[model samples]
Target: MATNNLINDMIITKRALPLFRDTNGFIKNIDRSYDSYFGKSGAKIGASVNVRLPNDPVVGDGPVVSPQSIAERSVPLTVAYRKHVSLGFDTQERTLNVDDFSGRYIEPSVNNLTGSVADIAMTLALGAANMVRNVDGNGNTIAPTSETWLQAKAKLTKQHAPTADRFAVLDPDTDASTVSGLMGLFNPSAQIGQQTKTGAMEAPLLGVREWINDQTCLVTTTGSYDSAATATGSVTTLSNAGNAIPGQISSTAYPQNSVIATSALNGGINAGDVITIAGVNQVNRVTKRSYGTPMQFVVTQAVASGATSIVVSPALVGPAADGSQNQYQTVDALPVADAKITLVGKQGETIRRNLLFNKKAMTLVTVDLMEVNKGVVDCGMANLDGISMRTLTYYNGTDDTLGTRLDVLFGIGVLRPEWLCIVPDIVDAG
Candidate 1:
């Protein structure tokens, strides 16, 4: 009898084969170890798994795998299979398995770099304000308000008095008529005119008779000169020389024998100077003016039975004629500039871009002869699915006058969170 030809049949040896009870079960298990092997034929498998992995190997031919061994290998196996998956589930769940049977969870940690930016901004603002309050260079203790800082400026100027000196002349021998006539001659406006007699005869007329007496003398007086001279030959002068003259002129007009003295004037005080007057105690006033005129004056003169009015004089120097006469005034402190917040990155842009581009290729893959498989694909696609990450950055600049940094972040309202961390290239505590 002729048997049916069996062209494609052959005898095979017995060997252990990996198998699962159900198709879904096999697919899930194969996905967990995607980086290793799966299927009926020797081909790479593609599927996604949500898990963290170990640095070491999991499965091999030399060792019998235990439950503990499987537990330890679960991480690597999950990471390996984190990509290729069917579209039956949600996007997030598809790449990141979240079923009750899928053993994995997600946790978020603080990004210190982001938190640091916020801390720096707050600390800088406080420190700047404190610095402004403590500054005492010009003894101006009051910190300048926003109005003063923005709208006003320090200025210097000169001052003047209301009254000045005049001069007069004395001629002991001249008669009253002669003196009067001479005074008329010195008048600012005196003119000669024609004189007409009863006959209408006109002739050259002499101007108002003004002449210096035979003996002329000069005298200086602070008070107004009398127009009518009491002395027969004395002539009073009404104009001054216009030049500065320094000398002591004796005059019988002032009160004599009655003492005229200046009370001891207060001088510049040091950091520690204290005094008590009229039942009031005061610290030493900083001496702002030394020469020129007294900006302030305190009178201790005694009045009726020990009563006196302490005269207070507040004289502000007037605007100066030019820049040369400008004087500098002292102020205790001034407001300073604000600080800045910034961001930085550890890796270069090129490297980051490259990693992002090939994110899919970095994924895990598994192969098996029992089932069909595909090689490695995008790692991020396997792990993150539709989610993508974008890098952030920050930088700061300095402010000179206030020894602070420019606060660019808040100005733009970009920096909001309070807690932040920063990693700096340099640590300049000083």
Candidate 2:
């Protein structure tokens, strides 16, 4: 694949990443505006939410005091690692028609790619805060119920998360339950039922608008999630400042199993931090083989003082991964260099990760445009809903063939970590 030389890349190319007409669900739900990130590497993305100041401590009677001036706290945001999707196709076969090229292939890919990116971003964010699971009067944990939604809402309420933008992303199982009258928000009688009579169910249960993210919803976890760090070691000490990713991130002293280590990036891991292990995924069902994906863990401890190796709670690995049983282990291994980590909070045990959060809890931060090119077919700057893409086609001189590719690039940045929480464990049809 050649680098996109927009200068040489010619016409018949469009910049926008077209999407499938039907699956615009995630696209319409997320708020994307380039007012901040455009033509830049990154920026300080945050907000000064309010003007109120902390209450002053009281003292015994004293002399007259002067007025004080204070500013609301400022929150900071950063772009996440860039993401992309690329494809190659026979140039002549697709020359049939541009719209045909887009509708048949590009649109569906773009739509799915967009949703997958959002889902991955949300997955990464789940580690930030895990919401409690709902249990019946019996001790058994139940699927997402009114109790689960309330618990998720409580997490944000304690953090002072704003009320207006609050939302809940329910998994399929829980979603079905809610729509089936479990939420206790609507009734078969009354005006609310009239909305259903017109063939639409009322949303915004418990003041949090609802969105279903089945395509990219979470279905990942481990057996022992609550155990504190079983083993601890100092892989490296994080230096406060550096121009690079910092030696602390790639320290050789770090052992292979899931153990405590220091975070050297500007955003280091903190207590209660639960992040996706780099290069890991949840257990795959098709093969009944977990390729060690969606590896997640809790941060039992973080040290900003003296030495700083985080205490990743729970024994991450055991005799299971060590060939004691001669079986391929899930989470192939512990996290590695630049494992994209998001503070998605935490959650109670569940197979599916249903979540409720404020809209401001997380964001897809855009950085540079990811485009593809070869010879003369040119496409330039184009974007949609805060996402940009480019495609190119040219002749393969050596193979005597022609080819084309399409791709997009962006990052995921969580603005407020505590504003979101995961409702773990909901059943999935797949």
Candidate 3:
């Protein structure tokens, strides 16, 4: 009858943390160094931490101290997501031991929360500039291979992504397909032996730890605009007279992080669709050397039919010969006026987004939640390996029920989009 007779909040909190850590396959590999900043109280949604960007070195003459002004660059990692799972328990359920209670309640709560976080994090994948299509040049989707993974790695290497802590996450079907394709290639070694025993790819292969993540994104259709479009104008300069120029210039109102085109986008551009403009090649992050591949842009927002403009992510920043461009330069050159626009796949096609990246490419930050000390409930919060979760158990006298809720506050950020690549496969139908 008393609240004290309910399950131990502290024990539930502790058990939930391990379940959360072990359940996620994708978010576990992302950078979580920013978690330390949000461990305190009053850390609310929209709270942000600046991730410092590396500065370019200046070649100076003979210690003359000709000081070139340095501009500090940073990307904001903001806490903008809040999610929770609440469950009601009967009297008998509350008296169970910690393990029994955890397996019955806490494990499922943590697993649901984990999948929610991974889904939210997948939105950041749209910002990736490097895409290794499972489809061939003739534009038909195929199964992924070891060479597919290697292509993703090569893309990251060209962008100068850190070689260590790399990962590749595939959908279950793609994982099975890739593993089956790789089963006959390697000698009978421990890595292969482990995979063979598990009937799946569990070991690191081709410089990346492979994972099967059901949360991997799948898009059923892209933009339906079939014919090629032409850029109405050009992104002439990064800025004019120290003032950052808006994407919309003059009467040609190009949306921010978007392109203004001359053709009527019939079905319009859809979110998650990949597109490229002729002559806009990708460049290395450090050297700014052209990789000779057209820079890929993923649509981040939907545009209406007959619209002349479309939105995209990783805002176009063309490279410069001098170090005059912004530190976040993304492409070798801007689209010239009338540059041809080409979509990657057919108008309506299924795409499974399998991701590969360096750990620094993405970041996930979790923060401790504020307690409800004034409420008539038992509350406990726990932090483990940069993750914080809280459990609240309360009694409802009307229905005579015990309710427990688990809550998590977190944020996801795309740090180095160049370091993130998508190895997409077709989501085959039955």
Higher-ranked by lDDT: 2 or 3 = 3
Model 2, span 1-430: residue lDDT tens: 3322222222222423445213544334544543254455322222111112223222223688744443232222233333444555664545545555556656666666667666655544543434566655754455666666776786566545677776666565666666555525545556456545543334655667755545566665333333222222222322111111111121111111234453443333444346554454433212224444354555533434333245442224322343331122223444555454444333333356666777665555454444434444554555455555555555677887655555444444444445667776545335
User: What are the per-residue Cα lDDT tens digits for candidate 1 across 82-110?
Assistant: 11111112223324322221222111011
How high a TM-score does candidate 2 get?
A: 0.58
User: Which tens-of-lDDT digit does each residue in 115-145 have in candidate 3?
Assistant: 8888776765655667787667878778878
Q: What TM-score does each of the candidates earn?
A: 0.12, 0.58, 0.87
lDDT of 2: 0.46
lDDT of 3 at 253: 13
Best by TM-score: 3
**Ranking of predictions according to lDDT:** 3, 2, 1
Off by over 4 Å in 3: 1-6, 57-67, 236-263, 319-327
Collision pairs in model 3: none
